[model samples]
Target chain A: MNAPTIKPFGECGFIAQIEGFSSDVDSGLFANAVARALRSNDGVDDAVAGIDSVAMRFDPAHLGVDDAREMLLDATNNTPRNTARAKSKTIDIPICYGGEYGPDFDALCTQLKITADALIKLHSTAPYRVITLGFAPGFVYLGELPEDLTAPRLKTPRLRVEAGSVGIAGHYTGVYSLPSPGGWRIIGRTPLALFDGRETHPFIFEPGDEVRFNAITPEAFGAIRRAQK
Target chain B: MMAIATIDRPGLQTTIQDAGRRGARHLGVPQSGAADRVCLAFANAAVGNRWDAPALECTMTGPALSFEMDIGFALSGADMGALLNDEPVGRYQTISARPGDRLALGAAQAGARAYIAFAGGMAGFAFFDSVSTYMPAGLGGLEGRALRTGDTIGSRKATMMAPVDIPDTLRPHFGHDWILRATEGPDTESFNPKTVRHFFSAPFKAGRRGDRMGLRLIGAEMISEDARAMKSSAVFPGTVQCPPDGAPILLGPDAQTVGGYRRIAQVIDADLPLIGQIRPGDRIWFRRIKAQTARQTTLQRQILIASFVSDFSLR
Candidate 1:
């Protein structure tokens, strides 16, 4: 693994950028490890993992900027480069595709020139890895979508996208954990709650977690949604 | 808990806010809080409350509220031409009200936001250890949303300290022209030297699309030398991100945890509150400063504030 270059992020934080790091499962796991290690230290306010970088915010009152940079460097150097040993879980998501739940479904199928069944088969057959969680609380970014499954985002984003809405853009698929304005092409909807602050673990997916989507009927979606409530 | 006031008019966008939600950005939560922390602290201090006590944050327009019980409140930030019982009231000092008294504020005469702090602190829904409202996710505050007409505001009871006045030297001033001190961002090298130099030299105007999320700056197009799409990375309040269109978006308190735009500069921590007071058509200039200087300035400002509000830290 290439060593990350440390740079000052504003006056109270440092961001470690790993050059030539791909947005893949292994890189995400390594970044997550480094962020976790940094967060454990005193004076670290927040340690967040990006696609190929780890940014840490520190309290300057407790630690100087130079000391914070050193701490970030030490955490990066000490974290294991090979993240295969990292413990991650596989989560299965049941999705209701097409019709009302997916407003852009027919348009996307026509744009991609694929039959509904073919598209669903391609999307569900392959397993994906969580690259990161961001944009909003519990919003999970899963990556390496099948090339044929990729689609450009909407020109004008919808003002309100319901929570659990599944969307595709460029090389990745993401789940909107909360109702928010989004531009991604809608493909499906999930019944499971992706975020619940009441729970000890608020997020459903973490970096490097394996994710598999399974097709389900609208009735099943309603049933699962009711069960969760 | 008891109802203190009833919202007569909700105004443009009034929401409950505090210091903000911290230590949850790693979970993709934005630090939703008072857009102007300095003013929030001052308002709270004037009412003899903790610096982080929950308060009402009114946008360009202020709300009309009627008190249901005797209460003490203070106002800070934008001069909103507040009136109590149809009589003009002063700001930065505590004002007592009796039951049935009405408090109303007009459109801001200067800044964009104003804060109203209650004597015993306002009550709101807490999420991630803060009452600050993050409207996008509908978390925190009163049902995690902005105040509306007919909403009854609640308050927490506590042994109150005598109301005090904030020193004039400690109060912040707002104007149409804003000069913000900043440091280089993580992606500052992505732009050419000429564009980087132009960023410092040029003056930009705040666009009408300003909100708690961010403010769009309209000025010279700052096209990046590297046209490759940037990977999503950690972003915070005050990160100046430039998109493909070259328009810079200055992130605010409600900025996303990660973004995919090219970042060229980061407004220093000390100057972040100024971003809150920026109104549409406001002229802004970014002044480059060393990281050490930014740190020193923040420390000095924090010391001054701490002397007035004990245990208050700007960071």
Candidate 2:
């Protein structure tokens, strides 16, 4: 792999970008590893991993800009280019597809020219890994959605997308862990809570976690939702 | 904790904010703190409280409250025209109030936000060890939301200190014109040289859609050379992002951790506080500076403010 390009993002922040790297599983793992290494360093405030870049913010009082830049360069060099797949856990999510839970279901079905059952099968059959958590707390971006399931985001985003709303846009599928304004096209809704601030772990999914969705009836979704509450 | 005051009128959007949650951005949590850290620290310092202590951050308008106990407090940031018991009081100085004293503040005369710090610092729900309110996630602050009428304001333990008056020279001056020193971004190459040059030279007006999250700038459209939608990347406070629509949005302390917009420049740490005080229609001009110069300015400002507020570092 070519050396990553390191540039100053702000006065105290630096971004080490891996150019020519596609948003694939391997790239996510590599970017996440670099971020983890950067975060463990002293004086580093935050080291967030993007799809193909790792942005790091450090304390200028403790670490100079040159030192921060060196650290970023070192992170890219030290991090194994061919990182061995670490032990990851696969979690199952129960989803109720098509209907009130998915506002864009009909439009998406018409656009894709597929039956509702075929679309559901295409979405749930493939297992996706968490690329990166962003935009909101516990919001996990699962990648490489089946080509048939990929859809464009809504032109005008919804004012409030309920928590656990399963959305698809481009080649990524994500769960709206919090009720927030979102532009992703919703096709299903999960009954499980993705984020619980009071808990020790807080988030259900982390980077590299494998996720598989299990289609359920609306009645089961209601039952699981009530039981959890 | 004891109830220190009863909120008679909650301002337009008043919430308890501290230094904000750190080390959580990787998990998608924003650094939602006092938009203007300088003012927050100054208010806390005047009352002899820790610089990062939780305080009420009032936006646009200020709140009215009746004290239930004697307490020492100070107001900083925007001049909200605060009055104690119908008597106008000055800002940036510690003021003592007796039980049953009512304090009211009107709309801001200048600037956009104000900070009210109590003697013992306000008590608020802690999330990730910070009480800064993040309304979107409904985390931290009082019940994870803004203050409302009839809500009781609680305090830790009151510790009265010798009244300290912040000198006029040390206090930050607020105005309609703001010049934010910035460094070119990690994605600066995404835009052509002409667009980048136009961005720095042209003056932009803060649009009406301004909030703690971000401020949209209305000016010359900054068209990116590469029209393809960029992948989502890490964005921080002071990141100037240009969407496909050509408008630029200046991210704030409460902005999302990552976004897909093309970043043009990032405001330096020293000038980040100015972004918090910017109001709609305020004239904003971005001054280009190198990262080394940005660091030097931050250090100079930190040293100047540290003389009055001990242990204060503008990081």
Candidate 3:
């Protein structure tokens, strides 16, 4: 594809947009190319790769915006078409579906006019891509759940969503790394810790990684949680 | 006595902050740091510590800390009517404290946050190579949360130094109203030119719900041209996002790494210190400038900050 247009994100930031990634069909390849290039560029201190574009944040103290813009533009022009895919790990998250762990399971199934078993099967079957990470540390935003399973956010958010709670909103599914107030519809909960600062790698998943969910008995979930302690 | 101190009373939301976790934005980590870097640096410098040294960033209400050893400390930022062992102390100056000395801070008569710096900085565990506290995800500082009463914080090393005060001319002016400079949009085109114009000229009051996450403004709604939800994009501390409902949410230091709303403008780095002082009900005004001008202003501010070496010249 052609080089993306570079725009000023803020005074010290720049966004390189690869337009129409939503329908481009090979948007992931383009996004990965930009993310890899910008991350390795010394002028750019941090780069966040979104679904279709990349935002580069720079320190004006060391690198001026003009210089940063040039380096980013140059990087995009040299998009490595033959570059290998970024290193990724496929993590299998053990989840307890449709019970006390999923407070809104019955309500969600009823609203969507689907059977609990069907909903779980559909959700567990697809491998979701990690689009962009944000909202909280290690909070993975996996996307494009089959159109049949897309759901709107709760009108009012829950006061506290337990850590490990797996939920869906719009076309995205995410796991809460910490207990925080959120509006997504909870479908299940995971026994594995998504984030732990003490670990060599704090986050279990990174952007561009693939994730699959596996249903487990609540008793198994309890055993895993206990062992994690 | 060893190099240690006890929190007699942890007022409001006091937490330890440093320069913040860097180079981790791609991992969705917020750049959690002192709300007012300028003041934090001033406090640290006064006590002969590095600019990014870990220190207590006390909110509107301040904490009451009692030392367990002789220590050198400095208080900066808002005027909190501080006291040392019941004797009134001052802001922007380093004071030597005895083992039993108590450093107490009263309600902020001006500004919204206060910073306290100890010599050699506070001893704390690091998450992602920084001691700055990110409360949302529970990382960094003391157990990744705000300070509490009965908390005992230690220091690896302490130094005894003579008192030094920042000159009045160099001190930041904290008040009920503030004028902040900004650079218009990564998403300004999504907004009507008229609304963008209004945004720069309108008077907005800081809403009560604001925290380190963001400052919600109430006044002169900024409407977008299409009002459609945009794809989630990168956002930083100073990003001013205009949601569909038209109200602007000016992000703060603890803001999420990305957002989907239309980010109409970004507050300049030079005037970011004013962000920490913006209290609920404070009147706010924005002035738009070119990206080049914002960089120039920040450079100028950096030069001024560097000149603050005067406070440490006596050492």
Top candidate when judged by DockQ against the true structure = 1
Where is model 3 more than 4 Å wrong at Cα? A22-29, A80-87, B1-3, B158-165, B309-315
- lDDT by residue (tens digit), candidate 3, B8-109: 999999998987887787777888888898888889888887777899999999999889888788899998989998999977877899898999998997
Q: Give the C-alpha interface root-mean-square deviation per candidate.
A: 0.9, 0.9, 1.4
Give the per-residue lDDT digits (tens) of candidate 1, residues A149-210: 98888988787899999999888899998887788899899999887778767788888788
List the candidate 2 regions with Cα displacement exceeding 4 Å. Answer: A20-23, B158-163
**Candidate 2: residue B1 Cα off by (Å):** 2.8
Top-TM-score candidate index: 1
Error of 2 at B22 (Å): 1.0
Pairing residues by index, what is the TM-score of model 2? Answer: 0.96
lDDT of 3 by residue, A43-158 (tens): 66788866666788887657866789887787767776433245367888899997989998889899989999999998999988776666667677886687878898898888
> Second chain of candidate 3: TM-score?
0.95
Better of 1 and 3 by TM-score: 1
**Each candidate structure's count of clashing pairs:** 0, 0, 0
Error of 3 at A217 (Å): 2.1
